[model samples]
Each structure stands twice: as C-alpha cells, then as structure tokens.
Target: MMNNATVFTEFSLSGLKDITTKNRVILFSLTLLCYSVILLVNVALIMTIILDEKLHKPMYIFLCNLCINSLYGTAAFYPKFLFDILSDTHVISYIGCLLQVFIIYSYASCDFSVLTVMAYDRYVAICRPLEYHSVMTRHRVAFLVGFSRLVPLLCQAIVVTMTSKLTLCGSQIEKLYCDNWSILKLSCNSTTANNIVGFIVIFFYLGHNLFTMCSYVQLVKCALQSREGRKKFLQTCVPHLLCLLNATVALLFDLMYARYGSASVTQSVKNFMAVQFLMIPPILNPVVYGLKLTQVRYSLLNLCRCNKQVKGLN
Candidate 1:
C-alpha cells in the first residue's frame, strides 16, 4: 500500500484564488517582510545568547531554542510562498508536500516543547531561586533541549512514515500550504488509525506539556507572595500564555474543522484565521519578548547601532 502510494508521481494544490490580486500582492509583500524580520530577529536572539556567556543559564538556553524553532517554522513555508507568488505555480510534487509538512511540524512541535520546558525553567528560577543553579545544571539543560527536539522528531517521523503509505487521490488540499489534517482529508484509505494516533500524540504531548506549564504557573504564583515578585511573575507569564492560547485555538479549530465541513465562505474566513495562527505566533513572539524583556530591547538597540556602524564602514 505504501509503495503504491509513493509510486503516484504528482499531486495538485488548490491555489490561493479567493484572495484578490491586490490582496495577493499585499500578502506577498507583507509575508516577505515578516519572514525576513523573523529570520534576522531570531538569528540575532540565538547569536546574542551564544556570544554572551553571562546568558548561558537555563532561561536563555530555552529562549535560544525557541528562537531557532520559530525561525524554522517561518522559513519552512514562507520562501515557497514567495516563489509561488512570483512564479505563478500552484502545483507541488508529492515529495515536496511531504517535506513541507515534515519541516513545519518539526519546527512547530519543537517550539511548543521548548515553551513547555521554558516554563519549567522559569518556574525553577522564580519559584525556587535558591536551588535554581543546582536544579538546572548544564547537563540537565542539555537534556531538556534534547528531549524537546526528540518528541517532535519522533512524532514527525511517525506521521511522515504513516502518511507516505496512504494514497491521496480525488482531493487536493485548499490551503496556501499543506497542513496535516488537510492532507489527511485527501487520503483514499481509512483515516481511523491516523486520527487515533494523532489524537493520542496531541493528548500525550500537548496535553501533558501544557499541564506542566500550568502547574509551573501556579507554583510561580505561590512563590510570588511579595508585591514585586507577583508583578514580575505576571509579566513573564503573559506573553507565553498568549502564545499558548493562540496555539490551542488553532489546534482545536483544525481538529473540529476536519470533522465538520464549513461553508465556502466560512472556510475562507477560517483560512484567514488559520494563517494568523501559524504566521502571527512567530511574528508576535519577537514582539512579545521584546516588549517583555529589557535585555531583548537593549540587544535590539545595540544591533541597530552595530548595523549603522557596519554600513558606514562599507
């Protein structure tokens, strides 16, 4: 079954047609700008942590991982989108589609995993500041990072392997990019196994990780009895909570949407929201962190200065 499915050479993509030409041009420009900023900002975040050994603690380490995942997520599809806009091609090869799904899932899932780990790190730092160093030692930090990548890594492998066996005939995906549920909808084979595995994975992975984060939140609150500590705790959790809410909504919407079909107009509106869930998070992340963290703002200022100096030298 898998071998035969792989033998089918090509797959058609339902192009972005509902959007007007003006909208397309605007979207193209905005997406390009957003991706460029996402890349540069995330790379800067990573480099800042790497260069500054003072920031080598667990929090910064997790932040670096988060930045990398955000970069990967935005980069996975943005370039292809730009190419499609320029070349006017709506079709993608089956292999290419699978690759897209794999890369996007890897980045996105890893991002969530890293966020969960980061919440724990913050909890340790704030809630148990006395033992923060002892608890989050270098080896332990490395383990968390490795574990974050490992979960998503294994999940993506399973999804791709399973999906490769299923035949996609008669239906083409209608999104700007190929998403998991959307692609699964096209499978000629029964999706019972896929749905079950996907649900189990989400429950085990997202559910548990999110629960851990929530537990840390409560702990952080308990530790923050002092007025200043309570304020700082709220400040730290706000951005993460917002991102988490956005992600949760997007996931639920995708799952439910797959089960119940929407009207064409409704689907279009949902598509717009879907893009928001995917694109907004990465873009908003830097903004959120920038607004929340003093260090990130200072780093941005320094980066601007360095760029100005380099341009003058050039």
Candidate 2:
C-alpha cells in the first residue's frame, strides 16, 4: 500500500472502460443530446420566470432559483462527461476531480435546501393563507434563496477541503465522476474526522428532508378540510412533491451505489445508478414544474407566441 507521503496527480475513471469504440460514439451522441435538452428546457423555464412580471411572486422566485440550480448542477458534470465519452481514456486531473466533487455534492445539498424552502412556501400558501404574502415577503424570500445557495456551497467547500488534505494510496475512481466518498475511500491516513463531518452533513440534510415531510403532512391535513385548500395543494404542492420524490430517489440510488456497489453488477446498471441523480433531477425538475404549474405553463405559451409574432414582423 502506498504511504501517506505518496503523491497522486490524477484519477483514472474505470466506469467507462466497458464501452467499445463503436459504442462510445453512439453513447456520446446520446449523451450530448440529453445534455442539450437539459440546458434548453431549464434555460427556457428560468427565462420564462424571469421575464414575466406576473411570475415575480415568492413561489415563482423559488422556482426560478431551483431552475437556475439545475443549470448549475448539470454544468458541473455534463460537459466533462460528454468529453469523457468521446475520449480514449477516462482520466480527470486532481484539481478537476476535486472541483467536480465540490460542485456535484454541493448541487445535491442545494437541491434539498431549495426543495425544503419550496415545501415551506407551499405550506404557507395553503396552511396560512392570510400570512403567506407577509411571511414570505420579498426580502424574506431573497434571504431564503440566498441561504439555500450559500449553505450548500459552504458545506461542500469544507468537504472538498478535507478530502483534498488526505494522502491517497490509489487514484482509481470507480465511477464516471469524482465523488467525495470515493476520494475518502482512497485516503492513506485516518478518516475519522472526515467521516464525522460527513455524517453531520448527512444528518443536517436529513433534517431538511424531515422538515419537508412534516410540512407536507400538515399540508395534507389542511388540504383535506377545505375544497379550495385541496385545489391549491393539487396545483402547487403536487409538483413540489414530485420534485422532492425525484430528488430523494435519485440521491438514494447514488448513495446505495457509492456504499455497497459490487463489480458483479452489470456495467450498464452501474453506470445508470452512478449517474441517475445527475441525469434525472436536473432534467425532471424543470419539466415537472413547467407542465404542472398553470401560471408557468401559460407564461411559456405567451412567450412562444410573442417570439413567433416577432419572427413574423421581421
């Protein structure tokens, strides 16, 4: 085993080794298409929310941030992933690997945080209708949005810093992208401090999930008591729930794969498990909110019509 003093400069990603040259081209095309669509849809939704004065409410503002985050998260992975698919070797430089870890994990944390805030927005709208506007004021919403982005970036920064300080015995990362736990697994020294900090971050985010659940539970209780409440819940809260469920399931798959994944698993299955979170949630969130929210849908339609009219006038 390499000792603490051993210097490693790069990591070879073994995840894409199974692809044949012919298959690599095909996969690269498909991946590029997927990434393009993720960008197109997310950008469209974000622009729709930003340009429409009618969508400047607290709920839409939260959604705009969520969409912005989807773009942020995907930018970290998709470009590099597409390049890896086309290249003969799948290796990432040390700094590149650490940057990926920081962006990906921070993106995950931010997803949960944004969803938690969305749940709170829904709860206020439905449970405390009279104070929804007051409670989720423009200033308060700005603070919460800023908080959602800042906290995750800060937490993941510490994780990346801690992981970077470790002396690694090996440089093979089993997955297509760099992950914090995977790097931690290569450490030549004690990782107790890292593990403790990791667990604390996990439990903190888990608490965010629990808070979301409690909010929904109360939302369900309140929704059932009134017809209008039920309508509001179905209109707004359902999409939030779907986004939450998608993010939760995607993260769970990633967690399980990182922890107990076996070589015996088929490469395709392993790849799917490894990237499910990165691939699904970023694409799914915007689609879900775009289709489910009436205001957003209408706004999008109006934007389309206005664009066509401009084309005709020109």
Candidate 3:
C-alpha cells in the first residue's frame, strides 16, 4: 500500500470507458453539435446585450452576467469532454483534474450566487419600484456582480487548495469528468476537513436558494395584489423563475447522482444524470431569456435584420 504522503500522478476516468468505439464517434458528433449551439446562443446573447445601449439597465446587466457565466461554466467541460470522446484513453493529469474540479464547482457556485443577486434585483424592482433606481444603482450593480464572481472564485480556490494537499490512494474516478467529491473519495486518509468545508460551501449556496425563494415569495405576493405588478412579473420574473428552476433541478440531479447513484443504474441513464447540468443550463438559459424578454427579442431581431441588409448592400 502507498503511504499517506504518496502523491498520485494521474487518474483514469472510468465513466466513458463503457462507451464502445463505434458509439464514441456518434456521441462525439452529437456533443460537438450541442457544444456549438451553446457557444453560439450564449455568445450571441452576450454580444447583443453589450452592443445595445437600450439594454444598459440593472435587470439586463444581471442577465448578461448570467449568460457570460454560462459560457464560462461550459468552457471548462465541453472542450475536454469533446476531446475525450474521440480519444481511446480516458485519463487526466493530477493537476489537470484539480483544475477541472476548481472550474466546474466554481462555475456552479457562481451560478447560484448570480441567481441570488438576480432575485434580489427583481425583489427591489417589483417590491420597491420607486426605490429601485436608488437601490440598484450602477455602483451597487457593479459591486453585486463583483461579489458574485469573486466569492465563488475564493470559495472554490480554498476547496481546491485543500483538496490538492491531500494524499490520494486511488487513481480511478468513476465519472465523465473530474469532480471534487470524486477526488475526495480517492483519499486514503480521513477527509473530515474536506467534508466539513464541503458542507459549508453546500450550505452557503443552500442559503442563496432560500433567499431567492423568499424574495420571489414576497414578489409573488405583491404581484398578486396589482395588475401592473402582474404584467411586470409575467414579463420579467417568469424568465428568472424558469432559469432558477432549471438550475436547481440540474444541480440536484448532479448532486443526487454523485451521492447515491448506483452501478445498477443503466450507464446511459447515469451518463445523462451526470452531464445534464452541463448540457441543459448553458443552452437553455440564453434561449429562455432571449425568447421571453421582449427587449432582448427585439434587439436580436434588429441585429439580424441589419446584418441581412448589410449583406444585401454588399
């Protein structure tokens, strides 16, 4: 047996090992297509928001941050995933695995943090319309955005740093990608410190969810009492609600699978549960906001029409 101080150099990812060579090609093509669409829609929405002066509002600013985060989160996984699908070997360097753990978890943490801020933004907008401008000022919005990004970066950095110091006994990870928990499971020594910190991070985000729910609960109660409030709720809050729900479900699926998923479960099902978070939110978020938000939809249409006109003139 390796001693406690011994370091592992690499890990074999067993998740994709079940995939046959013939199926890998098919899966690779489909994954490439999905990744491309995610990139296109997210980048398009981000650029649309950036270019249009009309969308320079607090709400749209939050939405833009959300889209940028989607891009950031997906970039950590899809490129390496696509490469792995084509290659026969499913291995990641120890350092590379730790980096993936940091990026993936931080991306998730950032999502929850951003959503919590968005909920607060909506709460202030609907529940305190007169004070919305004063409360969600440019400075405040910038601060909130920075807080959302920085907190996750810091938290995940701590988690990853803690994880990297541990002496790992195993080198086989049973997942499609490197996950913090999976890496933790490989430790031969007691992971009490890891578990405590992990729970703290988990509970921190759980509080974010609770805060969001409370905000929406109050927002819904206020919206119920007025016609204009209902209109605003339907126009603005519904998309945010949809996004929150999507993210919650995706994260839950991944969490459940990570904690209690069984080998008896069909590999296909297991694979779906594993990657659903990566696949769904990155693509669906921009689509939901783009279609549901009137300003964004109109801006996208105008941008397309101008492109077409320029092409015709050329």
Candidate 4:
C-alpha cells in the first residue's frame, strides 16, 4: 500500500463518457428501465414476505434479506453513475465517495452472507428433511439475519480503521467511488499493510461462500442417489449455481481488470461487470426461484391477485 499526502479534496472519474453520444443515450435509457424493474420486483418480494405469514419461514426470511441488500447495493452506486452520465461530470467529494464505497461493500458483503445462509437452509431442507423445521427455527432465522447484517458492519469497520490510518497526501483516485485498491494506489506511503488487509478481506469474502457451496454440492450428490430425487435436486441447485456462477465471474473480472488493465479497459470491464454484478442477481434470483419452484410462483400470483381484488373493492 502506498501512502500519499491528501492532495485532492475530490476526484474525477472518467467513466463511459468517452463513448459515442448515441451509445450513451441508449445505455442511459436501458439503465433507467433496468433500475425500474429491479426496484419494482425487489419491493414486491419484500412486501410479499412481510405481509404473508405463510411465507414467513427461514428460507423466505433470507430471501427478503437478500432483496433488501440488493436494493441497497444498487442504490449506493447507480444514482451517482446516472448523474455522471447525464451531467458529464464524474467528480465526487471525498466524503461521498467514502460513503459510496462503504455502502457498496456493506450491501455486497451482506448479500454474500445471506446466500451462504440460504444454502444452509436448502441443505437442511434437502439433506436433513425430517429436522428442517427444528434446525431452522424462528430463533435460528433471526440469528442468521442478524449475523448477516452485523458481519458486514464489522468488516467495513476494519476497512475504515485501516483507511483512516493512511496518509493521502499527494494523489487522488480515478474511479467514481472510493474503492480499496484505487485509494491504496493513490497513497504516497507504503501500501504493504493495506495490501495485506485487502488480501485478508478477500479471503473472508470468498471463504464462507465457497465452504457453503461445497456443502451444498455434497448434499446434491446425496440427493441424486435416488432416481426420483434427482430431478428435484437439480431443480433446487441450478438457480443457486447460476447465481454463483454469475457473481463469481463478475467478481473475478472486477478484480483482475481493475488492477491490471488500462483505464479504458478497466472501465469497459467494470461496466459489463457492473451490469452482471448489480442487475443479474436480483433480476435472475426471483425469476430463477419463482419459475423453478412452483410454490413461490403460485404464492406470488396469489398475492398479486389478492391485491388486485382489494383494489377493485376499494
């Protein structure tokens, strides 16, 4: 980690503005539509889980938490991004940038934790079918939700502690937000300690999720041994597999391209990764689970029809 004197009070980001105006317009419109869909669907999901006690199980609880996290994750970065595109300015103050980074990390981390918890829920539901209810009780559900929320806060606290110690005396970040590596790169002093922290954070980020995925894999294998169980097991695992695959690819590209590529290349890579990371999970999640699992779709449709009837009566 290089520690530099804080020379810049604000930093400018040269995001996709260098592209053609026509392309920018197209992207802006698409982004607006996508954001609208994300907002509508996630809000509906949260409300459905909250209003219906029948859906108030550990699984749906985690699903609701995931939706909430995705909402925050999108809100943290997308508004500023849209503004930058429209105004032709990517400059952000130090404080706002820091807030953006913290929010992004917080939500992203929470989402990861919730996914792990969801995997565990699935495991118990499949592998230990008899004890699913006992193992994933209300208290356990509350604990999982609480744990997911707090872990991200703790991780961010550690990050803030480390970043606060750095002396940004001479340089400024080039990105739209105050990212870890971008800030570290701007440090005028040695960045060794910061690098170490980053590595540790990555380990924490990947370790829990990977372990959970492995457990699920084993559970899947066990479930597949029976001919009748094979189809149901595949249905249960495929959505999760798609989500994991999308997230992993996005994260890998975000890490590698941001570090090694040229500015233009980095932005391009991040632009695509941003869509995958920000949009695909939320969009595909409900679709995956809803379409793959008939019960959820039926519940959602029932809720929709109920709402419509109530509106008509009113």
Those runs of model 3 whose alpha carbons end farther than 4 Å from true positions after fitting are: 1-5
Task: Indicate the TM-score of model 1.
Answer: 0.87
CA RMSD, predictions in order: 3.0, 1.1, 1.2, 2.6
* TM-score of candidate 3 against the unseen true structure: 0.97
Q: After TM-score superposition, what is the CA distance of residue 157 in candidate 3 from its true location, in Å? A: 0.8
Clashing residue pairs, backbone N/CA/C < 3 A, model 2 = none
Best by lDDT: 2
**Which of 1 and 2 is the better model by lDDT?**
2
lDDT, model 2, position 44: 97
The sequence of per-residue lDDT tens digits that candidate 1 reaches over residues 1-314 is: 44334445655555565566777788789878878888777787788777666667777788888887887777768888787766555777778888888888777778778878877876776777789889999999999999998889899879878887887754477777777787787776789998888777777667746676676667666666877667756677667767666666765565566566575656456666556555777767767776777666676667678889999999
Q: Decide which is better by TM-score, 1 or 2.
A: 2
Write the number of the candidate with greater lDDT, choosing between 2 and 3. Answer: 2
- Looking at model 3, residue 237 earns an lDDT score of 90
For candidate 3, write residues 47-70 as lDDT tens digits. Answer: 899989999998889889988998
* Per-residue lDDT value at 170 in model 4: 43
> Which model is ahead, 2 or 4, in terms of lDDT?
2
